[model samples]
Target: MTERDELVPRRRRDRRGRGMRGPAVQPLAATGHRPPLPRSRREVFDKIMLDVVTDIDARWSEHLGLVEYAVEDAPQLPDDWDSGRVPLSSLVRGSGTTPTRLVVFRRPLEHRAADRADLEAIVLALVVEQVAELLGIEPHDVDPRYPSDLDDD
Candidate 1:
């Protein structure tokens, strides 16, 4: 036979170089439960915040109930804001018929963190700071584990 007549199509090759032609199929794991996929970054951030809030609430039930927690993608920096200055978080005081609110900027915090542990620490600290403000106390007083100076970053 001529070279062209004997040639095999590129798509038909199998591991053993046999001309087995069919669609590829993925095999399912034999294990009863496959591991869950990792959570998205925003979901992880939300979970970390929720865990922190739950812990704080359990310890300080009286003050935590009146506060509302929220997460925004990022802070709205003013148009003329100075260079090298950005607000990572904020706390809003309640008005008539409104509850005090703590807002944590997710993007900024995620950008600042080097890893998941760092992100958790930053989130916890921000919550502690906002809770402290609402309670008219120091951040450390709100959570003894809070860093002495969270101002470094």
Candidate 2:
């Protein structure tokens, strides 16, 4: 073997190399080719939520009795940002004004999940829960077909 090859450890140089690994795995709903990696768990969650919020707005616009509704990122509160800041994914109550809004915090949701699949499940569940609360009904009532035993069936 070459002198250089002997100097460098075998583990450091493989088909996978130092950083690159196997092919990227794309989320099922992803439209385009897979990215090298998701920008971050939070970014992926945010993208997913954007699509979800759009669908919800379209589906519930009429039921809401208003032409316009808002879905936005929650503000990060000042103080020790590490702990004191409120997360970006929370839905906060708005003033009882003309247009209503539903906020979703991204960071907190990302932090809650162990992986991408878990993140997606948590996001879906959270959306359903939020919508149910907004409509003043139980989560099951919103969609009677909503799965009961989420783990089994």
TM-scores for every candidate against the unseen true structure? 0.73, 0.52
Reference-based TM-score, model 2 = 0.52
Would you give me the overall lDDT of model 1? 0.81
Candidate 2 lDDT over residue span 51-152, tens digit each: 666766677666654423333444657665677545544444445664555566666666777988776667666676667767776666555434566523
Q: How high is the lDDT of residue 78 in model 2?
A: 66
lDDT of each: 0.81, 0.60
Task: Please name the candidate that would achieve the greatest TM-score relative to the true structure.
Answer: 1
| For every candidate, C-alpha RMSD to the true structure in Å | 5.5, 9.5
Q: Model 1, stretches more than 4 Å misplaced?
A: 1-30, 149-153
Cα error, candidate 2, residue 132 (Å)? 1.2
